[model samples]
Target: MKLVCTCIGCAIEASCPYSAPRFYLGEGQAWARHFTEDLTRENIVKGLKETNYGRCVYKSDNNVVDHQVVNMEFTGGATATFSMCGFTRHQERRIQIMGTKGEIRGEEGKIKVMDFVTHENTEIQIPEQTSGHGGGDSGIVRSFLKEVCGYNGSEGLTSASASVRSHLMAFAAEQSRLNNGQSIELDDFYKKLLVQV
Candidate 1:
């Protein structure tokens, strides 16, 4: 079974809202696609250090079998509950764009555009009934396919740049938590990545 959530902090083992795992847990290319851009060794080390799982019982011996059993216990017990585990931070971001003609707000795959001048509001129903992350998968795929086929340029429910920005925001939040909740500049973080590339 596959489960998907905005972050690991939002997962509930007993009654998971998203069908996919809290984090990307699949193997092979499927797993690689979601994290390809941020799969640097430095990022891995940083995530590990921030989580502090090094001191947990799961790392006692470093043997594969022992580690797997211990890790399962650690991740499955009550201690792994969303509110108890503090390794990952939870966040829901809403982007609002105000144009002279109208305004657009998007979050969780739903988008609403309201025209202030005409007092008219339009709600877009994301096509495809997805059970993961409130239909984010459907919205993402539709937007990507539209762009790939050159049907539209930047007019879609969500663009690639927007998705990248959201991912970067999550990454920045993780960095902030690791640095004792210091404020992270999103633009600077994105700029740094571009420099690296």
Candidate 2:
């Protein structure tokens, strides 16, 4: 949808009309915080009262990457890539998964599956989401409570092994970005982090 929106903007205006909001997101109501807080008039005024987002995008004190790409390759040759960019016409996620027999394409709330052999297309409509991130905090909390209540084999807030691997991957990405895109071995990075701990 984001790509579509961007394309539409460009087609209609000869320029991407809704590209990364060219305006600066003020201090208290920083862009990142917008998703976490209610957008009351008072809050909006307060955020704009005293803020400095006027600095050029090329020049800022921010350490986080506004755009990045992470590529991972497994030992047996499987690979995956994740790319993120703040410059989008809309706030939407799009993904496509392909397999030998079929393929699935989806965004935040919709999906379509295509079967190779039968050439059938199936549309999947996601039910209403009651939680942010498609039931994020709610799901995690419920899972945690279930585990606390003695539920066996519960995936409570991500498995410890998975968390460790994810954290390691994130840290490695950051390190790689800072080091001019040098690849970092995951196992080696984990050992280094462990030593620090």
Q: What is the per-residue lDDT of model 2 for residues 61-174, given as tens digits with 9 covering 90 to 100?
A: 557787899888878877778889977745566788778899999876889999999999999998766666665567777877778888687465756876777887888999
Candidate 1 deviant stretches above 4 angstroms: 1-130
The total number of steric clashes, by the backbone 3 Å criterion, in model 1 comes to 6
What C-alpha lDDT values do all the predictions have? 0.50, 0.64
Question: How does residue 9 of candidate 2 score in lDDT?
Answer: 21
Candidate 2 residue-wise lDDT at 137: 68
* Model 1 lDDT tens row, 10-46: 3243264321232333222233234344655454333
TM-score of 2: 0.70
lDDT of 1 at 107: 64
Model 1 TM-score, all chains together? 0.36
